[model samples]
Target: MPSDNVYPSSNGPSQVDDTIPIAQGQRTLFEFGSFDHSKIPLEPEEWPVIIIGSSMVGMTLGVLLGYHGIKSVSFDRHPSTAIHPRAALFLLRSVEIFRQLGLEDELRSESASNFDLDAGMIIVEKLVGGKVLASMQESDPAEVAKASPSRRLWLTQNMFEPLLRKRAKEFGAAQEFSETVVHYEELSDGVLVVVQNVQSKSYRKVKTKYLVSCDGNRSATRRKEGIEWQGPGVLGESISINFKADLTPYLGTRAKHGVTYISNPAIDAGFRLESGGKAGFMIVTRAGDKKSFSPDSVSERDAKRYFKEASGIEDDIDIKVDSISYWSVAAFNAERFMSANGRVFIAGDAAHVMPPTGGMGGNTGIQDVHNLAWKLAYVLREKASAALLRTYDAERRPVAGLLMRQAYSRLQKRVFRTVPDEPELPDIVCEIGYRYPSAAAAHIQNPNGDQYEDPHAPLVLPGSRLPHVLLSRDGSQISTLDLIKTNFVLLTTGQSSPWIEAAKGMTLEIDSYSINTDTGTVRDSEGTFSHICRISEGEAILVRPDGFIAWRGEWRKDGHRDELQKALERTLYLSGSKQL
Candidate 1:
């Protein structure tokens, strides 16, 4: 139905400019054409991948693909990066993905604030001189460090997207704005897309081997593909008022509190501080019997009055209402993440939408593309079979379903103060401990095990993330997670020549590192590697490019090469048994 408005040549006179503006921060790494001044040639441009959105998720995918030497182009209807601070929290796993993409330091440096070790939620009748109702604490830093080398980030999406966009451009990924993907047709070999410029209404054709839609919840591509969402579509609605005010003086002893739930006769709202507690946003819900608030009806005066009531601040306090926005609190996951033909994939909010109570919406989307980008890179490079793409749906959709339930439950309890049937997993468990089924890893993973295990006492099982452990590589301290980035890793303990030999025989580049305290390859001086990972001498764990454990067992020289080869073949779908 979306393709019915195709702007074919017969639709109107051709006002084409024979040129298109260069994308923001774009660098000419791939020789796209012979046209002068880096302009379009008015012909169908073929790309390895064409992403339909250039927001956080789309830019992340582009950066990941470009890091793999895969060329991609991203198009978004917006003229630039996000203007509002959409998502404010990035979980540990999402931070880990950014770290893996070499953005950890930069992100932290640019973040408005980091969650303090003592950060938690405070409920009060008023911000100043009010009785506290309850206090809820987040996880401990020491506990989080045991599971991941990277910490959770509190940077807003508006600030974070530019970093990702710059990193993506550094890797030669192009990001075009003010362009919309009007229609697309999936072919046997690739996907043909019709892109229209917002200003000129001119159309251009792009042929990409794969099409990824990150176009938010109201995705045109998903609608065109006839993929429907399944879950509680809308739970509630509220208006978010983003403003600048130094509320630290009013917070007093609870200044370090990350979130403050304000409950009063005049207003019921939630306050989240940012910019080092100098700026923040308040989610204002309707007080009992109050009129339903709309963005159109709410003026700057109303926003300031709400802020003053929530903060219990004086009338003379300087509070600038920067923006007022409305949002639907919804929870849902798509019926499928991949198209019927498997050439088109949807990631981010397009595949799933959930409430932001737990800050998992954007993080889940970032991890979604982290799981898919490597598979796309491998398939596009012909290193893996097409069947590998099918695992994206099989693997991510279930995780999205679980996360949606978790988010909805959290919203119910936190915002509405009502308990739901969904059982709440621990924070670290929900963040990074969720495991995959054998459907993604083929026969190598446990299909019937629990979806998540205790991250503190990790099982180091297949389909789960490789547990993080502190190690010393050449006298420099590093995490076990630091070894995983671009290539598959074969990690073994003690002197394991057989694992190294097996890696050498593989056609794909697999880096083998033996953690030996004596030989000094990668020293596990504390034995935490053996204790946490549950691995001992002569045993090897095969880690996928995404840092999930694919296979782990004893590697004997008798048949080590054959065993590793079979594991890779089955896990990556190289055996040609499950081809689409």
Candidate 2:
């Protein structure tokens, strides 16, 4: 439905300058005119990838595609901040991804310190007419530390987005603000997006090979495409208010213990410290019986009343109201993540929205972008078949379904106050348990007969994530994850000439490294992968470009060359003859 105009005639906003100021030493982020298009080997007619919405998902996708040497355009409707007081928890896996993008330090610096909080779930019971509740004690920090290497950070969406936006600009996929997509049409080869700049009052049509809708729950693209979400709608309303008043004074001793959940019938509230106490305090309240609670409806007086009722605080409470907003606990999965017209796709809330019980929503969206980024790059670079894109839906849809189910489960557990006898935490439910069922994983056979049927268990199968393990080779301890550096790694448990030959043949195009476990050394002349791949048996494994294992077997086994060729073909989407 977008207009046929290739470029709009009018300029940007009159109030704001059309041209952005160039940094003192740094060059302008991206070139805008036709000349910029001509610089690439691809013609202007080549479809550009346009990502709608500039949330974390959109920003991540744009940055990844840009890093992969793909031309992409990202646009958002809002001039500045639209959503507020959103997702506060970023999981460990997300941290790993951020580390890879080199934004981990910036995120850590800008965001809050996670170590201070006692994040485990707690149960509470209120005595008649009493303000204090019989609350469970916080988990010991040392004990919680033993569960996982990474802990979820407590940071608001406001703090997180700016970092992502800045990083996206640094990666050369700077997003355009105040640009709303009016309409879009999917052509045979690309998608045409008609966008209007709300600030400038101008319009332009962009042709993109692929179009991704990272727009939130009420996505315009999804609606226009007649994609109906098929799950539970707004289950309950929750109010989040940001205040400066330290509740710690009231609960002098309890404050030392973190994340107190008040369960009194009169007042149900959850409180946590934000940004190591620098970004004020966060108070969450379930809008009991109220179908909806809007920011406009909840006055400052109401907040004060609730705070007093929740925590017997009547003393001189100096509170600065930063912002307050109501959120819906909705659970819905898109009927389809990808359009039948292959050029269109959806990620994040646009594809699925879940209740924020386990903080699965944001992390799932992050994974969605991670999955799509490489696939898009592969297709664009002609390294793989277009069919590889279909695998995205296959792999992610099921994962989304599982996440929603987990969210519901977590919600039930929270509501019922179900305390397990052992109090075992389902850590892997939101952690590194997701597996891709594409051709890459399909090629893997469980040779060791099924003893453990737990699908969510850490993957040790071929073509799966090589589980992290600690190793000390010649006194230097190294992690298994360090060996993988965004390239193919052939991990050999023993000497194998054929494997080396295959790796050498593909070294011209693909980055291939052979690790000889017998000698505790890798093919990298710089000795980067040597310490990481410390296998000392006859069994060997091959990892794909994205860190997942591509093949695993004993060295020089029967049909070893044939199986290796098949694995390479499936992993890289290359023909049999292409495997030299």
Candidate 3:
């Protein structure tokens, strides 16, 4: 555990404007919430994507876009990385996104693997008492293997952000800390963002082709765009206290668990153990009797008392208090995910906010950027149509909507004690099974017989994620996903010679309800590509750049080439456009 009495030494804010000329009145920079961005870089690069909020969502988007060859500038008002452990749970889908970015091993190394496979859940009478309530040990290892190649984790945002920040910078992202975005205007072809240096009272404007809002709960970007948020109002408030204490004696043999839900009905609290079992923990407690418990209002004596009670350790324990924060367990999402022009978009807490119990907020935001970045890169490279941009809102909004619902359900049972275990199933579903209803689904033929249904099963659908399966080529083993590493591919059967010829000069495919075959080299040795998929032997699936099946086609006895070309042209928006 990091020193309880000592916080990390200042590492300074990231370079905001590298070689940006100070225009007269805009040169003022005042101390803001965190660090001051007085340091400037040597070269001023024109960013293609302007991302507000340098938290998990924004940083993830910045890195994803940057890695895909899009330059972006990300800014946050916080002086440094998150000092507190806010968002901790990492879903498998989020891991998949990082895996594609070549960050799988690095993340897994620091992940919380205590208890079971880092996927276990525990309920207890109290932290100090360590009395078991109803606990679900880790899932079967076989079931875990089926879940994903990238596993779920219990790492905190404070730890996660630094990795994302470094990767984003390495991938050509310009990041600024302690600089807050004040205003932004969506132009006809792009967006103009105005940000202020809180400390210096200085400001600057950044122009980019697109703007992504990852600004978190009180998103000014969402509010400024006149986007309406529709959902249930606030359920209640809780005090999230970040403190340090030796819980070895308290946890005893139970220290393996990452989260312990305190069933001490009186306080209605939950204790989250940070990566190391030593000290750091954030105790979420119901705002006592009064309306809300503001950290400022609580004296050290009272804070210590509440912390002890929440820990179920009323016995005197030397607890070093760090930072205290408060949060509302409300579930809501923007009625609209993007501006009228699609030049601006919202993700993360800006798009939807829910109780942190399910840890869907950060993961959903990561997926949001994953879905949008590739499209933005394709459009910028002229490989896709501008109309394709609309799919961001079309696809991600519903997933966020579902996640928000799941979060609330978890809060109902975990916090309010009103709902049942329904929250459990949705948590799994939202993490990996939520489907998209965008252009990808619209153009693809649902081989499952019904394209409109969202069974939430592990099968691959047009708009859903492609199924994971191991494959072999030239005696080297690889996952089926490796085929679509950075480009769209056409996966078909060896018998479908016509389909092969159809893809002679075009690409549209990958699928679960897929019609794939074990050809000479492309073999689904695990029966994944053959027996498990819904496709026939003489069909082909068109996968997009994001590994989504854009469309599937059956061999036309007359000829499949002409139809294949048209669908490829339509999906890529390359009908009359020149390829870059």
For TM-score, the strongest prediction is: 1
Give every collision pair in model 1. none
Q: How accurate locally is residue 407 in candidate 1, as Cα lDDT from 0 to 100?
A: 92
Candidate 2: worst 10 consecutive residues by lDDT? Answer: 12-21
> TM-score for each prediction?
0.89, 0.79, 0.85
**How do the residues 387-436 of candidate 2 rate in per-residue lDDT, one tens digit apiece?**
77886787687778677767766655665356522232454534564555
Q: lDDT per prediction?
A: 0.78, 0.60, 0.67
Error of 2 at 376 (Å): 0.7
Each model's backbone clash number: 0, 3, 23
Q: Over 4 Å off in model 3, which ranges?
A: 1-45, 112-119, 287-291, 420-426, 444-459, 473-476, 507-522, 573-580
Model 1 residue 449 CA deviation in Å: 2.9
- TM-score ranking from best to worst? 1, 3, 2
Using lDDT, rank the candidates from best to worst.
Answer: 1, 3, 2
lDDT of 3 at 246: 77
Worst 10 residues of 3 by lDDT: 12-21
- Candidate 1 at 199: error in angstroms? 1.4
lDDT winner between 1 and 3, please give it. Answer: 1
Per-residue CA lDDT of model 3 for 479-536, tens digit only, reads 6656665566666655545666656545433222223334566666676665434556
